[model samples]
Target: MIGDSNRKMQQIPPLKSIQAFEQVARFGNVAKAAEQLNLTPSAVSHQIANLEALIGRALFVREARGMSLTPAGEQYQREISGILQSLALATERAGSAVGFDCLRLHAAPSFGLLWLLPRLDHFRSCHPEIQINLSCSYETLHFGRHQIDVDIRHGYPDWPSLEVRTIRHERATVLASPSLLERIPVSQPSDLLGQNLILSEAALVQWPQWFAQQGVALPQAPFALGFDRSYMSLEAARHGFGFALESSLLSQDYVKRGDLVPVFPAELSTPVSAHHLVFPRGHAEMSRVRHFLEWVQGQLGHVFNY
Candidate 1:
């Protein structure tokens, strides 16, 4: 019995190999997986090879187009993915248990940078006993599978089986640098027709919606500069590139700093959507999660009157 147990333990693959395989399985491209793991393509291939040897199965089917998981690979992924995440959480908790509490939080890229990051110092000062591991991504993660404590998502509250709350009402408003607005006068929504509009890919409200709300007509195929994230749009607005439609709450800091100013005197805000705090059901009972949730709500409410 002792010899059998020793042999079984020796068969286990290295953690690095498993991590590399998991990333490759999810991404379906070694280069993409390598980028995520900060490893080279050859190194990722080596790890995958090592893992396959340990399991005695081909984990991935290499193809001309891209890689696809084999049946065994898929089965292995489904079994081990959640386990790996749980292991990570356990490891983090072990460290926290020794000293301070730990909270694993995720947020959308722009919101993390423009909004949450600015106020994290305040949270740290208030909750000195808790350690926060904050991650930013545009892709929606499986809250339970990824073991995320809280996710700050910008969209309708439609995530099934999750406790969702509207943390901040995202008011879409037109903003531009004071210098830019001065050079190209924009007294009314219609005045913005001929001006360069900085478009954000993540914008919940578009130019047409804003124009329609103001009872103004939109030009067909209007010329505009596009960015993938809100932070980029805000930066463009600051540099006097063009007017951008974004969250009033997100732009508040910029507005206060005089980097950007509201386009219209009337606070024309779009009511299409808002920011929601999402977590797995029953997680609100956790002290760390609840504390952060309440604190963020108060902070955002003060910033944007949500």
Candidate 2:
């Protein structure tokens, strides 16, 4: 590349000349190439003329209306076009590697608002380089038309060919405000018989399923409160309205602040593999995806006691 006489004879053309030649060959007009390259038409034509002189071959056939590529120019264009595209792609990737990387994330509504959003400050503070685009919706796990890099789902998804890791394992137990417990004392699971039970209508694991797992025959009495979303049910339980069976992981901040307390013993608590981080297989291999996955794993790897 530096000193060999044979290599010196094969000197590479100036990048600008090659750029102008490619644009003109594709557009078949000096003015369009000049506009695209943000250079004067005369400048573009000068670059092309210089390139033709250096190559010892006329690259374009001059015409009254517009130019057309010669046989040599057609061959050169075919070769150089792919190289230019590759160069552009490489430049974009290099820029992203430095700091401009963005991660597109989608999460379930309640988990996004009540759990993930609360802890994003810590993640951002550490990795200021990575930008996160967070979206939340109740209808998740379907990547159909959305361009999501990662999905924060709840429960064991049977989605084949997807990389699913359970980020947070939780203890699903009775959660109630201190005032509510003081009003109706519950020493055993059977004591919840006639008590106000706040139910999450769309929850995967509901009170009926909890009782079925506990081998407790539930009464046919109507629930005291019903909500389709967990946040609302949790909020209602925090107001001393009724007992809400919720995951300890999602209600961690509330438990830490003593807004809600576990009403049942640890033995009665059901282990749920909840709060999964799902993505297409091998997606975590990317630096941006890996950063998020590693951050989440590090944050939730420890057990939070009730």
Candidate 3:
């Protein structure tokens, strides 16, 4: 019994030493393993020496050409490789099951606030088991860092190494506070010449574009107040600060509440922009990602026309 206990103690290598030895064995070169594991070659060699001492055997036979594993070392390497591979596989499977591994979603801040937030409850209701992390930025994502799984972009479809799906077409119209419209008489697009304009930096060109489509010359009297986000710009319009060109889908809630009113009738509409769902190329087959894309499409479809 005492002999068996002593032997068991000798068989266990120090944790760090075991890890270093595993890297060396897997890479089949001490220098390469050191680089891969972010350790010095000397440190790797020291760990291997300690591991050899613990096992009471020469694991590798040093030669003029390169080091080679001994008969015993080959056997140990096979066993250790299987154990490590199993551990890695188990961790990956567990992470996928819990959905806590990582799933990154990138979206424009205004759109996320206006459209996505309202419908997120339905997604959470359906995918209660999955954990979702969101990244809100105005700029495009760098997928090289593996930081994003999906991106919702507003523009013409052009992204490298991505599968694009058009979610909705952008249709914008002038909206103003009910109080502002009540105080001032506004019966046509030309009536906006007297009112203040709240311009969003993102859509600074939208009003001009829409006006050109209507064949109405740009107004030159009242200056426009500019804001960074559409939601804030809309808020300014809602507070009677100024009139803003807002997407119908985003302003639907306020319009329904009678807080804001559309400036022009539907017949005077023009093509503004388009929203798209972008995913990494070749990863479109992922089940969870597909589920999210489909859910967004269904929700946005119900809210926006096309």
Candidate of highest lDDT:
1
Clash-forming residue pairs, model 1: none
User: Can you tell me which runs of candidate 2 are displaced by over 4 Å?
Assistant: 1-98, 141-145, 302-306
Highest-scoring model, TM-score: 1
- Against the hidden true structure, what lDDT does model 2 obtain? 0.80
lDDT of 1 by residue, 185-230 (tens): 8777878877898888777888888889889888665657898888
List the global CA lDDT of all models.
0.80, 0.80, 0.72
Error of 1 at 35 (Å): 21
How high is the lDDT of residue 64 in model 3?
64
Pairs in steric clash, model 2: none
Q: If both were scored by lDDT, which would come out higher, candidate 2 or candidate 3?
A: 2
In angstroms, the error of model 3 at 259 is 2.5
Q: Backbone clashes in each candidate structure, one number apiece? A: 0, 0, 0
